[model samples]
Target: MITVERLTKRYGPFTAVDDVSFEVKPGLVTGFLGPNGAGKTTAMRVMAGLTPATSGRATVLGKPYAALPNPGRHVGLLLDASAQHAGRTGREVLTLGAILMGVGKHRVDEMVELVGLTEKEANRRVRNYSLGMRQRLGIAHALLGDPEVLILDEPANGLDPAGIRWMRDLLRGYANEGGTVLLSSHLLNEIERVADEIIVIGHGKIVAQGTKDELLAGAGTYTRSTDDEALMAALAEASIVAQRTPTGGLQVEAEPIAVGRVALAHQIVLTELRGADSRGLEEMFLDLTAGAAREEVAA
Candidate 1:
């Protein structure tokens, strides 16, 4: 439902988003990930029609977002929760959005409830609301139109643990019902929980794009052994290489059970044996962008 083809955005001489290409299809949540300087937000902004791309295109349903006749009904966006007017009540904010989207005012109440805001809380001014409350309000506004596509940037920000889980289920359910989502976030664990596919960007370029399983197929178990040297040798003899983590742990290129069998065969004792889970995405992300120039990996 969303497509970016060779999308680029430049500020002065610096490129914020390089020639990037990807797609977010119906019934899928694509996680956009990167480090501090990566162009995740910039790319998303372009997709949302909040910023002009330097070259190439970002489109929804084969057209740029600006070309949509009823963009609010075609795409729901929550780029900045703090962008809401402080003087407006939570209900007022969603009401205004509903009006602009040409939807019924009753949507305001429905969304307020959907986002877990009580009527009293919705009647309160946004300035008096907590950051989490503001986030909830923003989400309610985003859903006011019930758009086919959702473009959320850090939607989980300022949300408590339960709120985060609520958002995960909400988006998961949306996608299950054939909605498309493209979201950017620093919360890797949250992304791991809800994202079907991942797009990792660094230096404004896409370093990797794949399903969680496909990208993580190469990621192995994170392990620590009592006999580090012997464990390393056994792994080496088995033609398996282990990556050393900064925390002094080992990430072996094999499953924990396989690593354990090798350790036992070599009389090595393990102090830690855990599957390389969503946590491995961090390492994979770093490995993909380890150089000044990175080769893109797609699966």
Candidate 2:
């Protein structure tokens, strides 16, 4: 539903986004991820037509976002939850959005309830709402238009555990209903749970993009054992990537079955045998960026 080609953004002499290209398909949650200054937000903004890119182009459904007819109805965005007026009530805020989008008031009310804000709370002023409440209000505004595409930046920010789960279900539901979702976040674990595909960026360039299985297929190996000393010896024998842990176990970059076979052959009893596989999205993200950092230092 969204495509970016050789997209880049430059500031003065520095490039914030560099030759980035990717696609966000319909019926899937594409997790857009990167480090703190990796230009993820910039890229999303550019795609949304909120900011202009220095080079290349981005489009939704084969048309530039700005050129889309009634863009508010084609793209739902939740970039900054704090942009709401402190004096306006949640209901009024949504009402205003509905007016601008030419949507009915029913949508506004329905969204308020859908986001779990009751009538009394929705009628309360924005300044009185907690950060989590404001975040929900932001979501309500985004859904007011019921766009075909969603571009959310840190939608889970300031949300409680329950709210975070709710956000996950909400996004997944949108994708299941055939809507395209492109959301940005630095939290790899959170994204891992809901994202069908991942786009990893570092230093403003795409480091990797693929399904979870595809990423792990090329990722380095890992092994775990309760006896660190014995595990190290086993890893050394196999010449596999290995490390010792303080817990007296070995963490090796080898398949779990391989480790187990070696353990059995050597008559070594292991309390745990698992692939030193990437723990979660967070670990995969760290591994990619850390490698990038090392290359930078060497250069």
Candidate 3:
């Protein structure tokens, strides 16, 4: 399990992570999400001991990262896929990591294959690898130690649909085997599909964190009608808050029945009206991040 309690990080007067606290339980894939500057990366860095926390704590399996023996074997991290040496082959990178960790070359081959990199591909210098291949190489290096916990940032940044599916299944299997996985990514749809729990950060603080179902429960509807103005008027008269979405639809903060009634009363022709079938993560993320950005600007 990974525990973060009131973790904070700052650079001079600028706060990057502000009193963030959350737990990544064992046997779960936790998706970490936020906007461009939401401090998600900072918080993960603190947990991985890549960045020092100004205050509070981040621990894995009840101990801080620095205190763990052979930290690589306890926690696997893949923060940047492109940070490896360009001159070295993918297999060379993993082999060196394994050697330093006292692991044999056999494990290197195992990880290379596990991450879907064929021996031929792994033999090429990393400089020649595409972003997707780099990502795969990074995954191989991360799993080389067979760690019980994983902390990854944008691990699927350049993966194609099939590659993403492969990674999703791999992480799911790891979590099923009683491992803890915490990954930050901008891919909301992927996160929705794979994560057992989600943590949403905004600015420098956590605004929402919960299981997808818990967070999306009773989420409002996406409603639209042929007579947009009439529908809006009806909903407004009924004191139901409805906002126009960019795709020329109404996002109603009420159930389908309420929207249907409004449309019926106004004699409006309904084109679309649906419950919270969508992941709802995108909506919540935009709201949290927008609000935080506004606050930051105001500050």
* Stretches of candidate 1 exceeding 4 Å from the true structure: 223-234, 243-250, 256-274, 278-280, 284-299
Of 1 and 3, the candidate ranking higher by lDDT: 3
Q: Give the per-residue lDDT digits (tens) of candidate 1, residues 1-299.
A: 99999998888877889899999999998899876557888888889888899999999978989999889988999888888888989888887788889999888878988998898999999989998998898888888898999998888889888988898899999999999988887656777877989998888888888998877766788888887777888899998888778888787888788898998889888999987876567786666455554322210
Global lDDT of model 3: 0.85
- Give model 2's TM-score versus the native structure: 0.85
Can you give the lDDT of residue 264 in candidate 3?
A: 86
Compared to the true structure, candidate 1 yields what TM-score? Answer: 0.85
Per-residue C-alpha lDDT of model 2 across residues 1-299, encoded as one tens digit per residue? 99999999987766778999999999999988876667888888899898899999999978999999988898998887887899999999999889999999999989999999999999999999988999999998888998999988878878988888898899989999999999887777667766889898887899889986666554434545455567677668877666766655665666677777777777777777654444544575887566544222101
Q: Candidate 1: deviation at residue 97, Å?
A: 1.5
Candidate 2 lowest-lDDT run of ten: 290-299
lDDT of 3 by residue, 66-95 (tens): 999998888888988989899999989998
RMSD of 3: 4.5
Instruction: Kindly report which residue stretches of model 3 are placed more than 4 angstroms away from their true locations once superposed.
Output: 221-274, 277-280, 288-299
**Each candidate's TM vs. the true structure?**
0.85, 0.85, 0.82
Look at candidate 3 and give me any clashing residue pairs.
Answer: none
Off by over 4 Å in 2: 216-228, 264-267, 275-299
Model 3: lowest-lDDT 10 consecutive positions: 290-299
TM-score sort, best first: 2, 1, 3
